[model samples]
Target: MLLPLSMLIVAPVWADEHPGQAQLVQEVAKDTGKDPAALNALLDGAKKQQSILDAISRPAEAKPWSEYRPIFITPARIDEGIRFYRDHRALLEKIGAQYGVAPEYIVAILGVETFYGRNTGNYKVLDALVTLGLYYPPRATFFRGELKTLLELPDNMLAGPLDTLTGSYAGAQGWGQFMPDSIRDYGVDEDGDGRIDLQNSLPDIFASVANYFAKHGWVKGGPVAARAQPDAAAKPLTVKDSAPQWPVEQLEAWGYGPLQHLDPGALSSMQTFQGASGSEYWFTFQNFYVITRYNRSPMYAMAVHQLAQAIAEGVNSPESATQ
Candidate 1:
């Protein structure tokens, strides 16, 4: 399931003292030019459910590399990754060249997000988005904006209310787990079939992933991360929310330096991951930050990177050797 983005922030909710969810449904209807009464009716049963609101307002989990690394790089996942690449080789290559991102990275993201479109989710998107937008107080504004976007989508884009119900928890739908707004903004009809279908269209999904990376400042042919060794006298640095805030020069001044094999001119940020036994250091480049845009977790970014590498290596290896 696509995890709720609200997990990044949490706030309290007061139902009785507020304008009530009825007003929210009306607002969405008004904004989208749909009938207010119809929208209100659609939300009648949905508004009463508090469990969805409760789920959206919870804090996100922050796991160390020690635990996160193993979850994504499993043998089963690697095998699937190889199959994904082989199946979509042509489309992957075309999209990769167009966007200047590696095919493996795109494959890894799809593998991680929806298991190559095998498990998009079972939640109703309208129910999830409306529940979060109206009842979840912390990130209500963000989700409400998403709700407005969902309502603005052309009637044809939706698979009717019934088919649209099945998606991720946070209302991210289709292969790449794009939120409704993202689908509108970044999705592409790569197959030239006159429709953007991330659910069943491999070309659209591939293009959307590439488009997302390009928009997020993905540097073509750039290294994602490089091994780094800090001097014995250097103090460990802390990262809040897996963001790359520190510059490469600052990291070098602090006694941590990138590996000799990496280019000196690369723009890099210091990253320290807590392993089970000790700390692991690396210099993350722009491509690394691009992965974080999908999910703002260093562990997630690294897992995707490693999985992509594993997939590429596995694909090139002898078939008998891999088996």
Candidate 2:
């Protein structure tokens, strides 16, 4: 998930001197074939952004589903989401057909992440990566790997210069807010321009998002989820893993079922959530689990699901909305 970086605090402690710079110089310079001194100098300009450390400690994902629901599932966001879906009808449908992911889920993802390209932050990507990579030892190895991949990206692919590049404090960027490695692996030239520009390219962004979900095992023309009710004889759910682990028959045997019939042996999971609307029970299909791959939180998944449902219900002929 993308963390907004509008409130970043610039700290300069690590800019002038970081003992680890020497090792970084040797490692990155060796990989990139650039001069070690140049690499070191670039890092010397990277400040240890204290805000990044502070921000990571309190991510939006940490909030309970009750509070988190209103943040993304608002009228303004939903209205804007409908407009975005209407504007990009054929394109979203085309890619949706290609990737097996529904359009609304893709649109909901964009809506939740940056309000459809309106708020991709202003933090320098280099500083964010460096600050998190060197000083934040908990995830330093991961951030350092992200930093290495960011350095490897071509200038054409970046939103701006490495030193002045702007993105999330965690270093994800562009319309989809992809991490550096995600861009490298899932990024595609949907426009066939021989370059993938996530910043300005809508086709690339749509395809990239679709590619991400597809790679994570999104099922085409399959179920996503359904509201469930426990029968009078229902037993306590023993399933532990978050994803779809038990068969529909097993869940049914325990006295849970959807309003409509499902393949008795199909894989799914029973989820009990304490949301803004109070406790709700659901049977999530495999595709719902795929949405969680984009953001691991169940709240995120539920918001996406409900938003997509709202969009889908509104999109008949009178209006359009992506899920």
Candidate 3:
């Protein structure tokens, strides 16, 4: 998610000329009671990176499932995930049991977000937040809110100095790509070190990912998704919404039947994606929706689900015994 800040479209804009600097500083200072002068200094030092603005406009989530699946789910990534699991099996299992989330899911999130912490990001968190929050109009409000929360974060909660911290172009920090709000809300200090170091601490990273899923209502042992086998006379369907409001029987009546036998009364939804083979249909369940809470894109949720399944199978496979 982090690209080098290259090609400055124009001279860097300072805080004096930023559109919403005064109001943001006032609000943050009032809310956190931090020195207004210190906050001003921080913003004054933040350069509005055009690269950040450009990156936000073209998110990978915009890609189709066929194109998106290969990026995160791959043989190399799966093998690495198996190794990561083996390296952290005891901690992953312990957290998974405590949080009621599967260990594979926790690993899958890290695998997708940062390739298991290999690439958290390089953009300065301050500049990224400031550029999007003040300069980008489409999501200014949301980014500005994130900016404020970052300033409000207590010293004990952060792993390093604020000015030096780096994250995604969207200002998400740590292995799980947590934004400021998520850091404040779901971040865990699993090591009891009094700091939520998602970048360096393995326990914090794994537990935080598991905690996010658990808090979002991940159903333990519930199915995430399944391939659908539409009858020749199957009623044509499109992905209208991701919510699992339709009963399994209802989708069956609509001509989209799950390949695996599921409880006919269970609530589910159908989604169609342009796959490599052809149009592919899937039956998504409640656990599938829980993954979407981490990333709104259905493709993202599907990729995570598929990767988790792949990694889980690989870990237990006899072939992995040699790994």
Candidate 4:
């Protein structure tokens, strides 16, 4: 879900004139009562721009199943996944059962975001947020708000200003890729140690992730999506900005039928993805939409869904006993 901010730097804009930058400093001072002098000093010499502008400005890679599939469901990833599950099976199972989110889905998220704790970013979160908030005009307002929230974070939760400045290029830090606001709001002290250290604690990371999904209205035992067939007479459904709409009965009335059995009252949204066999269709439900909230891409959501299913199924397979 992290969009590269380097793409926005080449638009001939200067960092000093953003209205939100001043507002953010004021808001931070007002909200956290922190001495702005220290923060100002920190910001004064920070890099004003990213050097990766040309790298980010390139057109986004379209839905390339062949290319994207390997990133999430590789054999090595799956193997490491098995170990992750075994190591944290107790906590993961408890959280998954409580949140109605599959442990595999949570594992896939960790895998996707940080390679299961192997590559948790090298940029300081403070510097990244400050740079993007002041210079990235296309999303300056959003990043500015995040920067204000970052400043308001408890000192105990933060890396020293320098350490926080070096984590993710866009300011998302920790194992779950939480922005500072999300960290403050959704983090949980799963270890019962009175602290939530997402960067190094697996228990805290998994629990925080479950807490996030629960807050986002993840339904227990709800269907994420199902394959379906649309009648030739049915008018094509237009996908606008990846929002899910339409119920099962309405879709049927419009010439869509479930490829697998589905209840008439089930909520659904028509979704199409390019596959090697051609275009594939599915009726996505609320849980699927929840996945999109984590990353606003259907491909990303679908990848998580499929990888989760694969991991769960692989664990339960008869051949799994031999391993």
lDDT of 3 by residue, 73-150 (tens): 899999899999988889999999999999999999999999999999988899899888888999999999999999
lDDT of candidate model 4 versus the reference: 0.73
Least accurate stretch of 10 residues (summed lDDT) in model 3?
2-11
**TM-score, every prediction:** 0.84, 0.90, 0.95, 0.86
Residue-level lDDT of model 2, residues 166-278, one tens digit each, is 78879888888899999888888899888777778899999999999999999887888888888888888765645999898888888986778788888999888777677
Give residue 123's error in model 1 in angstroms: 0.6
**lDDT, candidate 2, at 135:** 82
User: Which consecutive 10 residues in model 1 have the weakest lDDT in total?
Assistant: 8-17
Overall lDDT per candidate, in order of appearance: 0.76, 0.81, 0.88, 0.73
Per-residue lDDT tens digits for candidate 4, residues 175-268, read: 7788887788888877776667788778788988888877887888888878878778987888774455776889989998888888788777
Alpha-carbon deviation at 49 in model 4, angstroms: 4.3
Evaluated against the true structure, the overall lDDT of model 3 is 0.88
Deviation from native of the Cα of residue 78 in model 1, angstroms: 0.9
Q: TM-score of model 1 relative to the true fold? A: 0.84
Q: Distance from true position, residue 258, model 1, in Å? A: 2.7
Model 4 error, position 290 (Å): 0.6
Q: What lDDT does candidate 4 reach at residue 42?
A: 55
> Candidate 4: which stretches are off by over 4 Å?
1-23, 52-66, 159-162, 241-243, 321-323
**Candidate with better lDDT, 3 vs 4:** 3
Which lDDT tens digits does candidate 1 get at residues 1-323? 66456433433333333465556656766667787666555555343245566655552335668877877778988899998798778889989999988999999999888888898876677767766777677888988888768866766454345224557768888888989888888888888877778888898889999999999988888878777889998877766644456667777888987776665555677778888779888888888988998888887888888899899998778982455
